[model samples]
Target: MHYAPTWAADGDTRRRPPLVGDEREILTSYLEWHRATFELKCSGLPADRLSEQSVPPSGMSLHGLIRHLAGVERWWFHIQFAGEKVPMLHYSDEDPDQDFDDLSGDPAQALALWREQCEHSRGIVAAAPSLDATGIHAASGDPVSLRRVLVHLIAEYAQHNGHADLLRERIDGATGS
Candidate 1:
């Protein structure tokens, strides 16, 4: 009898994390997958839909998510990790939640910024000689390792991707990672 191969579901174009390899390679690959998955969840959405607070009583929108993620990339990778003296994005002491609450600008601009931050993050990760390389925690006077930051980032994206999935389904009838 003939049998069909069980593959990842249709439209799943992301690379599978290495079956066996360096720890850094596996972690980074998984992170890239999560990032792409987040983007995929937001795909094909118009700016209006992207900006909709589809899940009512929550101020979260896809546009806001994009801005939030971009800020997170900078916050973790550049400011905390690379020790770049750059200002934080979408945030001030008075409005800590602006990243998720403010959706007033062009969403395309937010997306572009997200993409740029992602690229910058990739560069920082690549340049590091070891995952053991440490960055300072701005809130505390302790060091954080690149490995920990990468894992945390992957988790962050995965959690937000779940929110994105729900938002996309509510906006349209599409679903899946």
Candidate 2:
């Protein structure tokens, strides 16, 4: 049975990124659009379906992607950008792929965490004086600008959205951007 995601935007609800806007507006809009797209792709499936590894030999699932994106948000925004001391999500150096590999939790909970991280990320961006605001890259010990992080995140979501699209299609033959 198909279940429409109550929280996520369908085609009608998802906002179109402004064709003309300030740099910050443009970037944030695109990021928000991509996030909604990811969520949209995950809509209309039961938890079992969401967590099912429909793509054979590939461990990716809509639920796993949600968990992975939550971890990405924490790693980039909370840890790197905001310099928050929050514990990493579904990760340890000993088990780097836990987010995608483990699918034992409620998909709702994972999506909730993903939403929380996204909100925090927006706050960090808002608090910054400009896109030039810098964060320390944990791995490189190098300065990374908010602009770079935003662009990188957009790319990350875009790449993952493609995966989401395929996974969604395979699970139920549903497809769209």
Candidate 3:
């Protein structure tokens, strides 16, 4: 059977607005749009397809992408903003590439895990009082504002969503604008 692109809220449906607001709202709007884009990218994919590493050399799949982004979001929003070294999905000091390297498993399990991580990451972003709130940069020992992190996350998601678009096309001949 044919599958609708993940970005579609309903099967073949696309009613969601792309973005909303002014200059002050740009960061949040961009982040939300990217988040929606991520959801769209993952929308109609099967569990198996979602986890399949079609990009062999890169070993990047939609599920893996979600996992990696979740870890990234947690690092920035939770650890940095909240000042806590919370454990993250697919993260490890010994194997910095663990996220990409260790993705062999049931597709359903991986997808579920990714969904959970996304929800948690969203919560972190939502809990923050403002984008101006300060967060410590783990690498630089410098202060970074939540606003900066939000922008960075938006960029990251936008880039990955592009990859997702291509990957999905390769998988099933479905395409999105």
Candidate 4:
């Protein structure tokens, strides 16, 4: 049997005491906390449950959320940071909305893939010396720096994790701080 990557487990370790630091360190720490929080939101859920579309009118099951986020990380960190023209997995040119289309299925597999993507993203970010690392947004041809991507990624995860929290609670009445 396969296992989700341990790195994908999102727990409340983000609740650590605030740290006193320079601006860069503080921003980096904030991004890390959100990433961890996002992971915690889906922790311990079975494959079926993770893939279930808990919210109607939206294809955002826990599994789908994981996949979508992984894609986002790849877009911002890998493609943007490295300036590569990589193809998207669930996203397409015609119907770009398909990115969140089918998130309900194979919870373990989705989570594992998400973890792998996160690892790749983290490695790229870590190797960079400054957030000002340069890249271009493929869609807009707009300039995007590593710092901006980091902050945007953190915000994205934080928002989705909030949604995940509510969905998880609805599923099993399990809540985490």
Model 3 agreement with the true structure over 23-124: per-residue lDDT tens digits? 336666566667767777787777778877776576778777777777877787777766777776677788777766676766567656666765776676
Worst lDDT window (10 residues) for model 2?
1-10
**Each prediction's TM-score versus the true structure:** 0.92, 0.91, 0.78, 0.83
Cα lDDT, all candidates: 0.87, 0.87, 0.71, 0.73
**By TM-score: ranked, best first:** 1, 2, 4, 3
Clash count of each predicted structure: 0, 0, 4, 3
Candidate 4 yields a Cα-based lDDT of: 0.73
lDDT of 1 by residue, 1-177 (tens): 112232576666666666676888888988888888888877787877899889988888889899999999999999888999999998778998898787889998899999999999999999999999999999796999999899999999989999998888889988986
lDDT tens digits, residues 147-169, model 2?
99999999999999999999999
How well does candidate 2 score on lDDT at residue 152?
90
Q: lDDT by residue for model 4 over 62-160, one digit each (tens)?
A: 777887887888888888776767776566678775656765356677678778888888788778878777888877888888888887887898788
**What TM-score, to 2 decimals, does candidate 1 have?**
0.92
User: Candidate 1, residue 91: CA error in Å?
Assistant: 2.7
